[model samples]
Target: MVEIRTERLLLRPASMDDVPAFHNILSDAAAMQFWSTPPHQDEAETRDWVAAMMAISPGGGEDFVIEQDGRVIGKLGLFQFPEIGFILHRDAWGRGYAREALTPVLDRAFSVHGLACVEADVDPRNAASLRLLHGAGFEETGRASRTWNIGGVWSDSVYLTLRNGQRDVG
Candidate 1:
């Protein structure tokens, strides 16, 4: 009923069982510097977060946690609009994990979800995410100002899109 296996990752729907590790990642301020919220401080809250992610129906929004060797190192998936969001633990940086992890995420988004295109919005300052998105075959469309509200303050994000099957920009 769950689990979307990639070449090097074993992605699956987040569950209550993944709370501890999920919290560890969610609570890392440095890792989530540009996130919409501060670090999570409660153990029980992690489940609610996972539950919320699970609540994202494939018909609209969907999500999956990126795992390898039985541990979660990052997260990626579609959230309605065929838009994909990805977050990696800072420690997992510079190792090509993002590229490997995204193969299946993109595969599912386009192949399984039947979407014509997928989008990714990254903080312009987030070079790693930008590089990752580009390597995953996304093209920079433009910049969107005041696109995200992170802890009560509006911030800008770089919008990127990946076309699937058949789509026309014109």
Candidate 2:
């Protein structure tokens, strides 16, 4: 469980203590609009999710809880190797925190993990997230329609990747 610090944020492993704050973000409808699933219905669900995060096998993945000003703001890191995922509380949006937090995680993914590339799957309608990944050096690789069916609504996906060398791997 590695802990990371930025100028204004802290990225650390998820814990039971993070459940309340994390649930705040997970339960927000607007914040979860593009998430793989709908906003969590209750704190119990969040607890299960955090418990699962804590149980990931060593070297299997990382799930860093993003904290700012000593408060949990979101989560970032690869729960699955080579494929990155992140989400922030709606209140933390548009403040550069995601980009700031992403820098070192990408560094760790390539340098520490020695991965050839990192990938992301974003909902096409999530313009802000797409811009964030692009600014972090990810490039669009492909797109698919109706890739996710969440809470009865279907959403498409845009696949992007950032190679270790910061160049196109194609």
Candidate 3:
């Protein structure tokens, strides 16, 4: 596992110690609105999720916890190679942490991991996430409706990708 550092953040492998803070993010309704699943009802759910993240084989995937000043604020990584996912505490929103954390992860994904490209599936209504992906040089590949039925509510998806050595197309 690799530990990455940025000007203001640390991207490290997840651990059982992260369960409490991760549960806080996973349990927040506002933060989970665009997530694949609904807000978790308890820490047990987050524990299971974190355990799964920890169990990812080094060659199979990458999962990193995002920390700021030593506090867990979010996470950004590829639990499955070529497909990246991330989340931040609501309190950490609009702070540029996600954007800052993205560059290095994508770099490693292409360089160290030898991936040809990285992809993202954003909920069509999640404007902020769309902007972040777009700004990070990801271009839209396609769109699909009724892609996810989270908690019985249908959500559409916008697919985007950034290839290795690719420059911003916008």
Displacement of the residue 154 alpha carbon in candidate 1, Å: 3.2
The order of the candidates by TM-score, greatest first, is 3, 2, 1
Ten contiguous residues minimizing lDDT sum, candidate 1: 161-170
lDDT of 1 by residue, 49-138 (tens): 877887886588777887888888878877565778777777877887777767776776777777888988788888888877877678
Q: Which 10-residue window of candidate 2 scores lowest in summed lDDT?
A: 161-170
lDDT of 3 at 140: 97
lDDT of 2 at 76: 89
- Give all TM-scores, in the order shown: 0.87, 0.96, 0.97
For candidate 3, the TM-score is 0.97
Report lDDT per candidate.
0.77, 0.90, 0.92
lDDT of each residue in 1-170, candidate 2, tens digit only: 88999899999998899999989999999999999999999999999999988897768887789999899999989888888899999989999998888998898888898889989999999999899888888999999999999999999999999988884211
| Candidate 3 accuracy as lDDT | 0.92
Error of 3 at 102 (Å): 0.4
C-alpha lDDT of residue 90 in model 2: 90
**Colliding residue pairs in candidate 3:** none
